[model samples]
Every structure is written in structure tokens, then in C-alpha cells.
Target: MPTKRDLLDLQFMDARCKLIDLAAFLDRIERHEGEPDFRLAAFREALPILLSEKPNRARAVLEALSDQTPEPIEAATIQGAFGAPQV
Candidate 1:
């Protein structure tokens, strides 16, 4: 059960980090709080799969988006994405 990080031969780092990236994006945008409801919904749905053991990250993301529902998110642990400074 290798984590995505172990697959160094493959080049899809951004894809691997979609859930995390989305989460941070959601957190950053919460202050404005005017994002489309579906974006929030997608984030809510995707969170569970993010924690699961899945060989295929794309599949988890797809499943999460396939049936997203509205849910409120409490504060997320925000961090700099991909080690780049926040704007």
C-alpha cells in the first residue's frame, strides 16, 4: 500500500494534491464566502475520500464529485500550497 508520494516515477503531483489544494483554497476564500455553493459541496464530499486508502487518487476525486452535497466546513488548517507564499 504505497502512498502517492512513493510514486516518484509518475508525474502528477498537482493531481495528487487536488483535495488538499481545494481545501486550502476553500479556507482562503471563506472570508469572502461568496463562492458557488457547489464548490463548497464538492469540498464537503471529497473530504472523506481524502482520508481513505485509495490506490487511485483520481477515482476518489471522481467519486467525491459525483454526488456532492451541501455542507458547512469549520476552519481548515490552512497552509502554503506547494511551498509557495500566499498572495
Candidate 2:
């Protein structure tokens, strides 16, 4: 049986691989000079930072919840949380 940490690691690797593949595919395509694809561009830049910090960051988050308090949130109260709906 895989532990929570083990599953998190697998999911993270899967996500990272998908993102990198997307970036590579996009790079292979011909785009107009300096056309702003801000979303993908930002993702490409952020992926490296995310990958670099992943291990320590994931450990820190998981460590904050002790053995007794296994679940991060007992229950979530979504009432009055989100404000305006995005268009």
C-alpha cells in the first residue's frame, strides 16, 4: 500500500512531466515573434521553481500535520468564502 507521501510524490511527478511535455510541444510550434502567451510562458518559468522546491515544500506541508491530526482539515466551511464569480 502506498502512503500519502508516496502518492503525493507520484502525482507531483506526473504533473511535472505533463507540464514539461506541453512546454516542449509549444516550443516546437512556430509562433509569431513576441506574441504574448502569458499563461503558458509563466507556467514554463514557474515549473522550474516548483520542481526545485517540491521536496522540501511538500515535506513542510505534510510535517505540519502530525500523526494524531492526520487530516489537514476536519471539515471545510465553504460558506462566505468565495467573493465575486469570475467572468
Candidate 3:
């Protein structure tokens, strides 16, 4: 089993790069003039989960962005997912 230190040594750079990429994405979003986007809102809502000392942060974040309608829509709108609830 890998110790915490070993995990950090192996993954820290990759994690750091992703964090930087996310920050850059946020920067681009901030520079844009756009209407409110539910997907972006959901993404922001999930950010706090990363800071929490929870074992299931990935599951929590995925759930936060998921559509929880519990039933299928009668028809397809775009034949693809919006990546977050359309709310």
C-alpha cells in the first residue's frame, strides 16, 4: 500500500497541473460576457467538496452535477447530455 507521502510524490505534479488548468478556465470564464450557465453554476457548487475531508468527494461532486429527476424525459432534446441539470 502506498503511504500518503508516496501518493503525493507520485501524483502531486499532475494534481497541480490540473489545478492550474482549472484556474485558467475560470479566468477565461471571468473574462467572457455571458449569461448565467447552470453547468458553470453546478461546477462552482462542487468546488467546495474538493476542500472537504470526505472519502467520497468524487461521488459527491458527480452527484452535485447530476440530473436527479429520477425519471426519463419523454423525448430527446439534443440527443446528448448537458453535463449538468438544466435547472
Best by TM-score: 3
The TM-scores of all predictions, comma-separated, are 0.43, 0.30, 0.94
* lDDT-superior candidate, 1 or 3: 3
For candidate 3, give the lDDT.
0.93
Among the numbered candidates, top lDDT falls to 3
Candidate 3 C-alpha lDDT tens digits along 6-87 = 9999999999999999999999999999786898999999999999998999999899999999999999978789888888
Off by over 4 Å in 3: none
Off by over 4 Å in 2: 1-20, 28-34, 55-87
Clashing pairs in 3: none
Error of 1 at 80 (Å): 30
> What's the best-to-worst order under TM-score?
3, 1, 2
Q: Arrange candidates by lDDT, descending.
A: 3, 1, 2
TM-score of 1: 0.43
Return the lDDT, model 3, position 70. Answer: 90
